[model samples]
Target: MPELFHKVLKAFSSMKAGVLLLALLALFSALGSTLLPDSFNHLILFNILIIILFFNLSICTFNRCRRIKRLWGAGTGIIGGLRQWSLIILHIGVILILIGGMINNWFGESATLRLAEGEQALIAQDKSGVGVNIQLEGFEIELYENSMPSQYLSHVSLYKNSKLEQQSTISVNHPLRYEGIKIYQQSYGNLVEVETEGQGQVDSSTVLEGQILEIADSKWQVKVFKYVPDFDLAYGMESKSLQPNNPRVIYSLYQDKVMAGIGAAPLGEKIEIASGYYVEFKGIKPYTVLKVKEDPGLPYAGAGGILFMLGVVLAELKIFSKPGQGNGNRKAVVE
Candidate 1:
């Protein structure tokens, strides 16, 4: 058993083994990234291979140092002791990091809120059993020179059940965190605006205006606002630019009676009135989208990574100690 340990250690402690491990890690990462969804089984196998590599390296470092106390110098003795301790720490750290990653990937909780101005919704579901509600006071998007999105801004308040908690303005990359919930701005769009103008001999005029709450699996639904031909506007006496083909309606979408979006669009066009809200095709302004997350295992992963690196450094030192030349007993041992 000791002989086998020595041999295994010798192989693992070799500079060649170190180089090979680096190459293998790189290759595995590349392959994992390139694997198609169809190749998920292959990807899982590769992930297992990586974990085995980590564990094997730790074991080998320990086995290699078992007989090093007999070397002819203090350098070899000290390095052997350090390698033994580092091997243990490295093994434990790798196990923790791997377990934490798996737990986070499969069990993490998340929710999406379709918030309108001055509206609130409870973010449902949490693995830790915590509940949170978020109120969106106002939401706005800014545009760049060519009308691409520049930033998203959301004024929000947080509550726990019925108690008011915290409030802040969230933007792209800047999330409002209350308790463990992270509210990230993922994306935004023109929640269509629909209206009817010039009620001149129209066949069926039931202006259905609302936001397409979501789009998934080729299915769509819109929250309908009341039907109106000449929807009253807060601005100047509703522009009378009524065209036979294109008519404009000026009304805003409200989640809780606050404007989520505002614009004017032609009525009865399949494109405009197709989805939830129908509005003129004004370019969407970029909103500051933010993503929120609460990763309980992130700190553990970071610590494990750091400890694993330290173990590698210690293991490297153990291998490079040159055995002293002796007068009568000098020999090249396998380990």
Candidate 2:
């Protein structure tokens, strides 16, 4: 075992080892992305493993090489007192980031809940129901001068067991955090027209100018994501039309088997397909999606970063020049 360790150390101390390890890590990262259901776990584990390997290789190489020691001293203030301290600091930083990511990935909790105005919902699955409940007061979408969406906001209040905890606003990129729950303003939808026509009882009946439907039933729920009018069609590519006066919705319907969706140009044009019933453009109402998440490992990651930086300073501040005198920047060779 010791002999094997020596051989491994010798290989890792070489440039070839660094190159090979980097290549392997890159390949594993790419492969990890394509893995199903087990992505975060595998990716985090691989990341930490590679960091350890790199640290070992760096330490071994630094200990064996004199030039490495001088470079480490030149790089940081604290580790600068010792030979190869910069290498150690650099290794520590890599380890910190890896560990941070691992903790964040493993312990992070995320969920999503839909609530209408005056509706309150708890954030997670708990038997005790001891989680925060968020009440959706109102939702709005603001457009830029060019009519493009500039911002989306959700007006909400958080409560814990009937007690008003806080009133907060959430927006894209800005999340609201309370009681270990983070709510992200993910997306929004507008009011749309629903035209429902049934067979037999309401055969050949078209109910245009219908209001939006926001109820979940045994089948699929309907929601209006976006509408575009004056849609244009280019060659080969799917066309887009978003003239408000003649709006077309990019809508989706999620079901158990079929995930049916349509980018209905001019809003409601019937595409003939065999389904349960005929399709219609239902009414539109505002829809807001909130992403809730909690992660316990954030502090550790932060601490690691600070330690890594300190290590860097320590490694660079310490310098030794061959036990000889130096003329300004030039070291005098001791005979």
Q: Looking at candidate 2, what is the lDDT of residue 161?
A: 72
What are the Cα lDDT values of the candidates?
A: 0.52, 0.58
Q: Give the CA lDDT, 0 to 100, for residue 145 in model 2.
A: 70
- Please state the error at residue 242 of candidate 1 in Å: 26
Q: Which stretches of candidate 2 lie over 4 Å from their true place?
A: 9-86, 113-119, 124-129, 190-282, 310-335
Task: Give the alpha carbon lDDT tens digit for every residue of 167-217 in model 2.
Answer: 988999999977556789977544455543323122222121222333223
Tell me how candidate 2 scores on lDDT: 0.58
| Strongest candidate by TM-score | 2
Q: How many backbone overlaps does candidate 1 show?
A: 14
